[model samples]
Target: MTSQHEKNTGEFLGATHLEGCLFTGEWKPRTLTAPVMEPATGDQLALIALADPDQVAQSAQSASIIQKQWAATSPAARADILAKAVEVLAEQTSEVAQWLIREGGGAHMKANFEIAVTIKALRLAAALPEQAQGLVLPSVEGQTSFARRKPRGLIGIISPFNFPLYLAMRAVAPALALGNGVILKPDPRTAICGGHVIARIFELAGLPKGLLHVLPGGGEVGEALCSDPHIAMIQFTGSTGAGRAVGQLAGRHLKKVSLELGGKNPLIVLDDADIEAAAANAAWGAYLHQGQICMATGRILVHESIARAFTDRLAEKARAIKVGNPVSEEIFNGPLINQRQADHARSIVDETLSQGGILEAGGSGEGLFYQPTVLSGVRPGMRAFDEEVFGPVAVVTTFRTEDEAVTLANMTDYGLSASVFSKDIARAMRIGDCLHVGLLHINEQTVGDDVVNPFGGVGASGNGATIGGPANLDEFTEWQWVTQRDVPTAYPI
Candidate 1:
């Protein structure tokens, strides 16, 4: 496998414009002192501006000022631009994948797949403006009433590092489609991948200068963006703790906020489940992207009858997964995004073992590589079993009954997503109905993502949805009610 610094025959894509900013319509790119680093190797990727909070404020101000004029542009015209952006994405899919690999710490294949999915999401969202519909209420007292969805001025998006392309574009596409100018604040770790690409595309599509500004910085920048009065809404994807902070800031500013927070999602395997299939599914759900996924099935609730068999199979698969540098096409598991994440993951596993949990198979490996680990005999109080393990670690616990499985599944504060493995359709339906997650999968793993589904979690996960989901498009817009009455008369006594 090639080290991060090793040069490839493919073209190198450098990070552009962090401080001075990129002017879209005017066609300009300026220098910034901020620098980007490759998380995998801690190598300097590019010098980005450590943009001041004032720059975030300036971005919101500029976007808000141009929002109305951009909103006035024909929706079809906006759609055309989005379509062009999608085309650009499709043409440069490989280039996008390389950036994702460097920044998000995913293998080349996974990054490429995410790029394709991002394009599909953008295309779906772009088609939405034409089909966006409003509701017409029944006339009350001879007055006609109807509602129209209007653009919500400026929106601030804060994306996570796990999904460099999908998460960022999911919000950007819908926000732009709804005629809202967006200010994107991506995770500093993977900012250059999605942040830089989207900014470049918007500029190439001739979008109004400042309509979609990319402010690539850290939490302080995000806090400023959320609190800025010029921003009407905030869309954030990050940890539960950070989401709470952003929520508080948005609340203080009286701005709408959509947050997709952390999860310790469960995978329930019933007694009647296909053991082989369930094992395979569990391995994919828990170890894909090294389990650095909000929806990754971190908790395994297997029926007592099959728990031993399932654990053995899962451990075998986990051990067999190839781990190496992200650029290697054959690598099934890549290093964690950085050393911090690896250490955190290791700490959680260590705590679990120290607390009497058994490490079933793989453990810690080379630099930034936490082995795909499965722990059995996990107690409820154990942090590894209860908390979100944002790495390749799985906790397996047995349940005597379906009720026990459901109870254990819903025990956490997160309700992002869950999955069940069973052959009986009726039982699957019943389990699905009782699952307290925002999304439930039957006879499959939980990492499945569809553009049309209303994808967002409930409970502490926050408000609103994303992708081309029906609800997501609406979240980007404002509701305007209209009432018309004939022969209206008013009298004062």
Candidate 2:
């Protein structure tokens, strides 16, 4: 890191630029550069050259060539490298948190949580190498058949801006541990945390050259990765629109794709639940990371009996959360990823207010720091209730019955995560079963994720493909069945 890179000084988003575009074994320079801006303040972090098609093509070619070498290494060797990456990343936790907050507009807690999850993900991935095992199948009198898993040649990861570190590493660690080369294309806005940081981690871990390459850019680079001959699979995390496009391209190229798209997740609060606790859970779910999370509670459904109580407490909780520059650990609600997201969040609140929903806590903001908004009486017909507001805006809708609550929750085309709150665990589980979601919790909120679970959703939220746990073994590798005989069989007539 240079002085320019470390310093917070300059004309907000000044002319600071670096020449590096690709990081294979080392930083490779290119003429095309893109600016990485701080979402909270619109300040320039750095301008780095973006990788072009030809540059990425060359790297991808080499990565595919060396991928075999990485695969041939012992599983213990692979696991050891991943284990070392965990230590390397842990040592720089604070430094990486700075990149996350300064460049990606993540608050202190969000930064720390993201880094912690990343560390755990690496540790989990380290164990995956030894966990991969083949299966034997019943065979004929003189033959044997078995299935073995082999690494995909190369994987392309296009991670989103929010939760950059963990999302990317959740794929990178597993792919590398499974012995596939990787080409990462992080959102240009968060290249440092998503691209640069991973490169440094693996580099220190002594990963072979060309095994992991970081190329940060926009749609062009993403398309190039999808269409590249060497990239056999793509792991994408972003909006459904972008994911749909990536899916199409990957499909056209006859490559495997894992789409972790947007979510309009819902969290339900029944009258039998503890009102204050449910409100607290709802507030944290919707406001954490400014609601810039796929698992963020998009809609909160409260029983009409306790709707008044829940709304009041939720509003109070929303206003109490701190909001400001993410440089400090005290600020609870930081800025959205950029102006567009902030504006979009405001629009959701404003549109709901205009449509007869009441603004319970906040509705106005300046720049990228939108207030932790709470909208009550928001019905399904309103934008806030129906659409995914990827910001710190919590939309509240009241339900007359459990059936209505389930109906409202499952009304969306997106089904990622859902939560049901009640004093009785059995009833909560019953309601949870009725809602369409990939993840569910009776006493928990929709916003938290760990590295050990198979994380993903169905419908527009995702394509039913999971990311963590045993799913990683399947996602990063292909199964090949082998059959053998002790001697040559008699020829058929």
Candidate 3:
């Protein structure tokens, strides 16, 4: 039986058998299991299988075979199934929202937004079947020739803990829509909501069995997905360090790979900007999901003239946001996914403070809840400014000129997302052009996104591969050239 989450209570129960792997049209419960704990209370909610390499290969083989059959079906058939999946998922929005909060520590609004985006992504996938367009090419000697998009065989998708469902679907939906089989390796920490639930949704939507396999495993599982011969490509979303390893391993196997890595994004606040509005965006960008998002505003660059005003207003908002157990409280902020993450965030704050960074507000924490933190006078050469903290800590740095702001914004090796805030739209556009990132916004925060747009990054943030809209048609498939002739042409020889 598939695992089910108990609303209001942190319990994940399966019938007589607790299933972790969804393979070959069945939920298979394994022998060895790891606890899936609630981040808020450190309670063990359920147990998921720790998949081995052999099991991964078996699932990969199954998906590859099933994908061919699914791909052979008409494009209209694929679109209809995806459309059904969207409807099924929409009907169970409340259940998905609870899983988001309990498993990943997202607040209510964040949960709702995630649900909406996920549904939107599925709808986009529904359109991809018809949009996987082919081009007729001019052929020599009156021969008819064309290039068409074809599925890239089986695809290996490794999703992260934060925004588990959306990130997974960011790759999964497109792969399925484009007639590719999927071997999903969601982070073990969020297996149920991120992995099996996706399988369940598609199953309820009438997707053919075994086309998708939800295998929640650790590094070994990811390694198998990267190295397995059955998987044609690997789409990974996680830290740069981890992404590097995936890229390197997948490279050895001669497999196509997409790495959506870490980011140290920036938000430039000009003196002309409204202090309150800017502060709200900063708080949202830095503290939403406790800043666990890869696109979280890593640093804020402000015009030196209004540096103090921005910092003070930002600090006030930082302290104003309530942090608590997401399941039991009405709060904007929640736990840090696990004790280790909380400890790492705390250590970064301590190190930043000891390194001469001044704490404007929230330098304290208890257990997993680190208060929304703000550090001012934070400049280059400080941990808070240099590293990807991935916590609810906002680092404030001042720039003397527009050139300096651009320099500070592009200082990081990461180039995921950034934003420019100014009342003057022209100035905002000018500043935004100077920044190097995949997604840039004017008068908006760096944290937000719409799945309908092309999404990915450059340099350390991503390998230039994108997900969403027409881009997915390319990301999930390869090109094939077909030629036909009424009469046989003479051989060149």
Candidate 4:
């Protein structure tokens, strides 16, 4: 029987041992290598080949060649291939989820959920080709005019470590379905599962060679992809700072770019909200996967009348969460991605406490593991209230009026997602409308996404472009207007 390393090397990389980037259907080694470590154990899992600027250029050129051919292929064929990819992904869900848990430091349930969402995204992308339609325009009596969607050639996808599979496929599936070749630069931390696993699945689904390339590395590789002229567009998911760099690079090249960046999302619990239900959703939204999600509830805005009750229940729920090994089925909170993140979370909590915030639940753990923490009496000046803490810490702030709640919710530079929980649908909707976020949830958690809905943000969160559903196709394609006249027309001159 093959060991884990041997199996990953042979099956995933097609080499005796994992070596380098998968460029244009070939496994090529790089001069430099980065070590991929398991966050939970702090053990080196493998060394991934880091792609330099020259290698990034080569991958872009090759993708350009393949994209032209793919774009010329029939839409029906593309849709069919995407449909087959869904089946291939479904078969490997368990294996992929295991990789996510080990490499990404995610809970088992969270990993599985990521895989499930990826499958749904694939299915949604499969139907896009058939549903894609152009519009007829009114024209002069003797002329006809219309617009059609055309592929944008090569798309460069830079995905984050958290929810790597789902984030990568969120762009990959749609780009492929729309007949565009993709160069995927997954996070160096999740190269094995996010980059290697995805490449293998697409190959099994019968995607033509060179159409999908996985070049796993650090920021240098992403910089190369973003700056390459051959790459027509870039779809990125990461922190606001990183997204800013990507946007700047893409803008310099005059290329289309879509960014799904950081979020200091808020969850508002109105006085009329069910206290138990609000607390439960808050726990799930803020503590799931140790709160590494971009849309995790960073701030909880509760009505003054119920703030104490809500904070009490939220603290109780946080204390009960199993914070341990990600592989354990009973565990809900897992380790952060690395020591730095864990340290960052701790520092944030300490700063909040220093600023006169109350720590009601937990504030201590070992190594990369951080306990689920709840902070009350958090004010605007506190770091926990103003900054995005991508950890299992929920900061609660009390507001006396609905206006104050909306003001508090929209008080951050980040505006990715927000949730309003109230028994009255109209009241919840009113609050949600006032929050300056890209996605708003009513009577639900902020950490939620649908494959058929537009997923992105505004302000510092991201650029205006979106991913998922029909928007996916729109993001990867351009419109071409065609006009025809049966008879010759006279020139103005």
Candidate 5:
């Protein structure tokens, strides 16, 4: 009998070409190519051409040249094109979702959810023109002064492997909607869905040639794009180390950059909270997408009074999740992106146990699959508590007072997102306000996000620039001040 993963792989192979990169309005092969493998079965899916420094420079130059023409086009026309692109995305949802699952090693539900969220983001981006309102300032008599936003010539985007399509469009759709050209470099592991699929969709939607380009490659290509003179700004989503490198390089060039980096987010469960509901939410936040998300909750801070009950419920929930092939709808936790990640996750669990943390349930699995793990008695100095374990693992620690909970939650170098759960809404809101994170949720999970909300991080998480919502338009644009006078003024003596 054919397995569900095999069936999905066959459908993807039959539907799309396995090679080629998108240049300015053209599909072409490069001198160097790399093979992309299916993480679940370790099967070679396709070869993607790697863009070199020269190719990245060329693409950046093309985007700079094309941005002028794109900026001249009316905003309404651009919105229409984006709306059509959304329609095209809806039409190709199943194929693209399958590609995401095969390449990124995410479950079926996650793949479909990513597509739906991406489409919604594009729709929100379609309103950028109207949302980018200008201001008129008071001026001296006979003089008029006002300010409006203008497109930065070209933007370079570097997206990660997890949620490839959704993260890519978070920057791409808004840049295009704001009349700026973009050159995107997706992670080599997910080139098919992030580069090829997106390129094809925009082309079929009748977007002007040269306005959007997809270059699939490794770090060298991303470095080239960051340093390219033609590119005006950089928008990146990835690990903290990579983000630091990109941010430093962009800083030397005096170019604007936005980064959405890693997180060791915390979820606090008060004594008055519903134990079952809190456990379910914590499990979802920690184990969804196999805990690969930037905002995945790595620490669960529970009041000492309810810690045992909460930990028991969470452990039961974790044990119930089936870990296997992502293409199967019955499976909840799929394999990590690759073997190295699995080893890292395992090591973290091992270190936690060695450091006196007790494992409540699930500490091992086969191949790239690390079973969903629950740990208790985790302290601030433990590896699992301090570092980000980007796998299906959750660390639980007990806190006695609100001050202790807040302190324990803010103990890490990351401050990306945090969640507070309590029966008292007012108290939850108060605690949420005190948590030092870019995003906070009251009586909810940490993994949720909306397209219309400003979604980025603070401290080590990002550079304070917000993505999504109306703020995204600002990231891709600059302000131009205009002043007019009826009569020339004399120079001061």
Candidate 6:
């Protein structure tokens, strides 16, 4: 193992640029150069060049050619590689966390948590292959049939910057477990950590060359990856707009697409809710990662009767959140991934304030810190209510009735995740059923996630699954039907 100083010696400590790892059924290095920056303070991380489109095409073609051969490898063998990869990931967690902090600006604890979640996901994927089973049909007329699972062809995985490692693995592992070749594209902003870690893990695991490739570039590379004819499926995690664009491109090629897009996820603070618990959860869920998470509960809809109390408590909590460098253990919030995101987050807050909203708490701070802002009196037309605010800004609105809470929660085009903070289990369950979202939380914030349960959305939040629950496994595998007969029929009568 190389020393930490030795490992990062050549690369820019804060100036790391975009890089690529082109795996050809076997592990190998390929290069595309482009520049990336740190959002905390404007600093050049690295200069990256776009991978040769022709090379990307060739990589896809190579995977297309070798996919069946790799898929033919026993599931046990595949699982072994995944397990090895997880071991490698565990060894490199610290290094990966550092890169995540430099690139994405997640606070130390949050970055560590993301790394842990990634490790768990890899372990789960490693275990899934052995558990792949088929149903055997009852014999009919001396014949029987069973349903089997098999990998789809090459799967292109494009992930966003927020929660880079976890989200990337969320899409990649299931496909790999089912024996599909993966061409992965990490978000340009946070590519180094995820791109480097994945490449190193697979290399250490001695995976086949063409099985997994990490292609890191900007929108052009992603667009190219999505449209590549040789790729069988696209699993993407990003904004709704980008997801729509990718969906269209993939659809044009008649490829399967799994888009885990944007969220303006809501939390309904019913009158019967626990104010202290809700406030704490809401503060963390909304401000963690500086609120860059897609499923971060950005909106709080409280019962009007308790709206004043909830708003005051939530504002106090939001103001108390510690903000500092992503590597600081004491800090709970950090800068956005880049200036563009910071500017966008600020713009949303400004728009909300200008549009008949009251600033109830911390509104601004240095760098990318928005001070865990809370806005009240937000109406339906305001962007704060309608659009996804990917920052430390939280919107609070009041609901008079249960139906109103449900309606307010579902008002946005996003249907990723929502939470109902009610002590009454029956009311919470009823509200959960009515809310249009992929995941629902009772007496909790909207950030609850389970690897064993499907995580995705309906409506504009995009389609398909990121975390492959039991049903989600079908996303990576295709169906095959076979018929056998023991007796032969006479040709002619």
**Which model scores highest in lDDT?**
5
Candidates 3 and 5 compared by lDDT, better number = 5
User: What digit string (tens of lDDT, one per residue) describes model 4 on residues 163-202?
Assistant: 8888999899999888899999988888877787788778
* Residue-by-residue lDDT tens digits, candidate 1, 214-330: 777777888898878899999888999999999998998999888888888889999999999999999999998999999899899999999999999999998898887776546
Per-residue lDDT tens digits for candidate 5, residues 1-493, read: 1354346545333223455434557676565888889999898777777888988888888778888999999989998989988998898888888788888999889989999999998888778766645789899999999998899889999999999998999899999999899998989889887777778778888889988988888889888988999989999999999999999998788889999999999999999999999999999999999999999988999999999999999999999999899876558888899888999999999999999999999999999988999999999899999999999998999999999999999897788999999999999998888888999998888997788888888889997647888678678889999999999888898
lDDT of 1 at 47: 53
Pick by TM-score: 1 or 3, better one: 3
Steric collisions counted per model: 5, 1, 0, 0, 0, 22
Q: How close is candidate 2 to the true structure, as a TM-score?
A: 0.96
For every model shown, what is its TM-score relative to the native structure? 0.93, 0.96, 0.96, 0.96, 0.96, 0.93
Q: Write the per-residue lDDT of candidate 6 for residues 1-493, one digit (tens) a residue.
A: 1243345733322222233233344434445555667777767765543455676787798777777887898889989999998888787767777778878888888778888888878888888788846667666674667778778899988888888888888777778888888888877677666565676677678777766777777778777887888898898888999999999998989998888898899998889888889888888789878888888997899899988998999888987887877655568888877667778888888888999999999877666666789999998999888888798988999989999988888888888888888889998899999988888888877776667777888888877454567755778887876555577544797
Candidate 1 structure, TM-score to reference: 0.93
Ranked by TM-score, the better of candidates 1 and 4 is 4
| lDDT against true structure, model 5 | 0.87
Off by over 4 Å in 3: 1-24
**What local distance difference test score does each model get?**
0.81, 0.87, 0.86, 0.87, 0.87, 0.79
Candidate 5: residue 264 lDDT (0-100) = 97
User: In model 5, what lDDT does residue 50 have?
Assistant: 80
Give the range of the ten consecutive residues with the poorest summed lDDT in model 3. 9-18
Better of 2 and 5 by lDDT: 5
Model 4 spans > 4 angstroms off: 1-4, 7-17, 21-23
Clash pairs, candidate 2, are 33-49
Q: Over all chains combined, what TM-score does candidate 3 have?
A: 0.96
- The TM-score between candidate 5 and the true structure equals 0.96
lDDT of model 3, residue 323? 91
